[model samples]
Target: MTNKPTALPARPHFSSGPCAKRPGWTPQQLATESLGRSHRSKLGKARLQHAITLTREILGVPDTHRIAIVPASDTGAYEMAMWTMLGARPVTALAWESFGEGWVTDAVKQLKLNPTVITAPYGELPDLAAIDFGHDVLFTANGTTSGVRVPDYDWVPEAREGLTFADATSAVFAQPVDWAKCDVLTYSWQKVLGGEGGHGMLILGPRAVERLESYTSAWPLPKIFRLVAKGKLTEGVFAGETINTPSMLAVEDYIDALEWAQSIGGLTALMARADANAAALDAWVRRTPWVEHLAKNAASRSNTSVCLVLPGLAEDKVKAIVSLLEKEKAAYDIGAYRDAPPGLRIWCGATVDTADVLALTGWLDWAYAQVTAA
Candidate 1:
């Protein structure tokens, strides 16, 4: 029998979304000046604008692109882009996981765009060469549920007739995004940044803005989804004036996270942290006999949501392992996504320390032994 590990991860917050907060983060670390003020107030607008500026700086988003704070986290931002800009062109939706499938449903059922759907099962990727760039393409940069990610943007053409809408909620900060290839990109504060939820960031390249000015959706857009007014893009929204009231507290928390990123040597450093954490977990997975990565290709594996499967284990047995880990408080929220294959999903984002991931491996071994022995 394997012995229970003595050391516990200092912070056992391995949830993929609302992920572990930055190292040394606390409520007191957030600024309170914007807390009670109106979002339209001078102080509030400046803070919101500051968050956008820091995002562009840290992400190295070119000046040609516009960034804005939107409502309802990543889902909201992604749907907003789809509702506003998709009907004008032929659509191609890619799915390799639950979230990607959700977008496919939206394109087929809700928008009635009758898009060409391309899919790969969990732990795999759709053929990149098969996609037609002549149509608007929608894909998640990282399969948050399946632990799969596109290796890079080299497959995308430099010039295309259609827009590339990248739902990059989990990829932003941890992965290098080729901004030129993505016309519409959306992410939320709650992902890699580990900030509070309920807010999203929408980034638009020059092409996306041109589409907004030229094309109008056939269906009626909700007040929150409207990006253009009087046939011109709403410039103020990109400049920190949001379409709806925002949670200033959340905005402050996001700013705090961005500033933390800047202090840690910017985007390169954040990517390095995530890479190191994932590498540590990968090392363990490689040596372990009972577990294997859900993602078969190392190049397509996600560094943020690193999923592992116990081959031949029944689903109930997998659940038992998850319950055991949580009961012991050795790990939290590391279970596989409900829709994903039965397995374990450990978040290895920039906020997570490699030591915590390593320590959790010992607990995983102990938990596996306990569960299997029964």
Candidate 2:
């Protein structure tokens, strides 16, 4: 193995969630104009609306879609959609990782919906052909834990009778989502945009709106989950009228991130940046002897959260390597998800620099050698 590299990544923030901030980001970079002001004020609401508009623009969302800043992060957005729109049809919940499994738990235990659950082990995709699209389908677009992603939307039947609810928290902005196949899509700013947490963005297409207008759940709907009132969709919710108070600071932070996205040429540029970061690691993984990508298939490998499986290494040894890396200040929060098979999880989202990812591979090699030599 090579000697410990003298050079370190210029930036080492690689946590999958609450990912590294946009390039050149600093706390002072955020706009303070919206702080200390009522969220209901014209300026504050405009800020929220601007975030909504910029998000749509960057995402290339359809004109027919309704975008809302919802309560909580991506989970809240998913729950809101499930609570509001399921039971209209038979349900299908697909799982290949922890987050996908969480949706299954909600479907079977909490919502009490007798949905068909199709799943696979870590680092593999479930049989997409076996899915019953005649029923409501809920799944995560990217498996952040397993380093697996549903390759594309080609598997979703075009003539299906159900709506597709995609939890794209880790995929949006970094991956191109086939909006034509997705009806209800949700993401949080903390993922790709590198913004503050506590806010979720929910986008509804025509079919989703149709379900909201036509279907009503038998369960009790909390005020926060209520998207309809007096027999009509709450238009104001999509227009930046939030159900509860929101942190204006988080709002402004998201706007700043969105502005950064725009400055870097929007979604296309963002995907390229993330792809470059992942490619840097991929090039290294190709030559690495002791470790490999957790994702077994190249087609399903995620570009945003690149999980790696140490082929012959013990999980404890992997943890020790991670601890060593952290102690050396070479990386931080790079451990695999607790629920996932033990390995390494690196953030290759757009906010992370490609140079840093390249530098990280060298440290991984050094750390691996150091651990094994002991």
Candidate 3:
């Protein structure tokens, strides 16, 4: 009953992080960017400003919310928020996967903050219903490693006591975030959008700003992590001014990506694209009994980084199938995260075409058959 797939995917770049670039992207597209110039110069400033403006317009962030492009990737943005803001209140760190667990470690081990740690194993969600919103909450919007995402913000009470920080590096653009319930959200350009890495974007709602001005961490703050001075928020950081030197080339590539986002509609369209891409693969998974989604709850499953668990296959068999697919140039970097349970992790973000996803499934089946028959 096994037959090789007749057609190949038109595009096969699908790494979850630094995911596939916008269709037809090449080095030639960056020809007009400011090169070897100071980011503070007028032309560079305008380019950076354009990126910030389009981001705000497309994402529909609140008027009071502030967006900043900072050094390092999403990790820097998240760590900045944690170092500057977490000690303000008793914190609640939630973890169902690796990135979430990283934040928990930062809270308890690094900052030495006494906080409540709530956790769940892979393939299951933490008890979102039981979290005490009275304390400052920290959670990832999507678990890139395990492929679980919070279905919605309805679980959080409206008039809760403390701020909510969301590490949404993999969630933005692919999933709709209810920012009304969120205080601090952080992401990098390299995720949903196929932009260059090396920078992070931090979006701060009104309450998040207020916390920055009002609270000070007991631990020593590094220069890069400092977000306040003279007991007031550094407002300049939000207005295209960065805390450190940023890659002008990366800045331009991001601008191009943002413009591409605009041309295709806005966040609504981007999310729809990701959903459709995920659906294509999901349909195939439903018919394939050997594999199932890593996220046990259907509602909690991620549409972007779709993780799948092989029911009874050994790790070596899964790795061999991954190697076969890679050797055939049918898929790249679809292996599950190293720490996560043995499985396949596919990127179905907006940048990924549904046709490619549909094509990839055949390759998966072919690889599985090749491994099983041997």
Candidate 4:
């Protein structure tokens, strides 16, 4: 073996999710006193509330939105919105990739709700004109699996009667989100924030909050999924007062990540870093032949989960090369999703440096040549 590629620091984690944390991350930043304590306790509640406040401030969420630090991960946040809002009317779901398809499946099958699914091939988004906002709408802000994203909120209907729920799990922090366009927005700590998995941050604008309060669902609200009670907004739950106990450790990790984002000049600076990193890889991708981006439209592409399809390679051979890359530590978790065609999925989110992306691209050039030669 030439040289075990320099290990990713002690914690140079580059997994697409539960990814590498931001620079200057430290466990000492966590308040140890809140660790073993009950979340309902005064100290525990304070820490939790602080985390909610800081995250909202970092993301530029509006004052009218209620942010909840929920028990489940991003999945929980999405499910909560579905259960609370989906039954009221017909649902139009736009699915372009795996995660988006999952939400559509949930709406049509799991939730047992009436729905219309408008789908595009893996690399493309649905026709925006087909979206009927007269009914409840569900979509993913960023398709984590395909590296495709909505270019902007301009396509969303401005004169819509129903609510819009967007799962922005991979897009938040890495890009700018227009809160005005979404009624319910969901994310997890493990994505851009690089915190431990387990906590879901659910942001509900006033319209979504009103739906939760006024709407009556035919199904039971799982203790973990309940968002409102007796036609009233569950204000306590959004204030770090959760319906169930949460992982203090994970919460602490999220706090550290948010503080790091703030110290580096908040969302604006973070967006610039993420865009620059993705652009570095995009420049390389444009020049490289073996790997091409899976996204069809450059404008609709995602800056965070940048996926590539290795054209002309046997799928099995691609898998073998991916294993070799991981063993070499040149790249890890770059394999395309199981449902997707064989390729590479590189995380170009803010936490990952532009220099590292360039280095990775250089290694990719070398690896592709080696694999093809074999």
Ranking by lDDT: 1, 2, 3, 4
Over the stretch 278-357, how does candidate 4's per-residue lDDT look in tens digits?
Answer: 99999998998777889979999999998889888998778877787777676778888888767888888888887778
* Number of clashes found in candidate 1: 0
Off by over 4 Å in 4: 1-12
> lDDT of each structure?
0.96, 0.92, 0.90, 0.85
For residues 64-135, write the lDDT of model 3, one tens digit per residue: 899999878999999999989887778999999999999999999999888999999987789998789889
How well does candidate 3 match the true structure, expressed as C-alpha RMSD?
1.0
User: Which ten-residue region of model 4 has the weakest summed lDDT?
Assistant: 1-10
Ranking the candidates on TM-score from highest down gives 1, 2, 3, 4
Question: Model 1, 314-354: lDDT tens per residue?
Answer: 98998998899899988899999999999999999999999
Q: Ten residues in a row with the worst lDDT in model 1?
A: 322-331
RMSD of each: 0.6, 0.9, 1.0, 2.1
Pick by TM-score: 1 or 4, better one: 1
After superposing candidate 3 on the true structure, give the runs of residues whose Cα lies further than 4 Å from its correct spot. none
TM-score per candidate: 0.99, 0.99, 0.98, 0.96
- Return the lDDT, model 3, position 231: 92
Candidate 2 lDDT, tens digit per residue, 1-374? 66998988888888999899999988898889889988899988898889899988999998899999998999999999999999889999999999999999999999999899999999999999999899999999999888899899999977879999999999999999888899999999899888999889999999999888888899999999999987789998998889899899999889988899999999999999999999999999999878899897999999999999898889999999999989888899999999999999999999999999988888988998899999
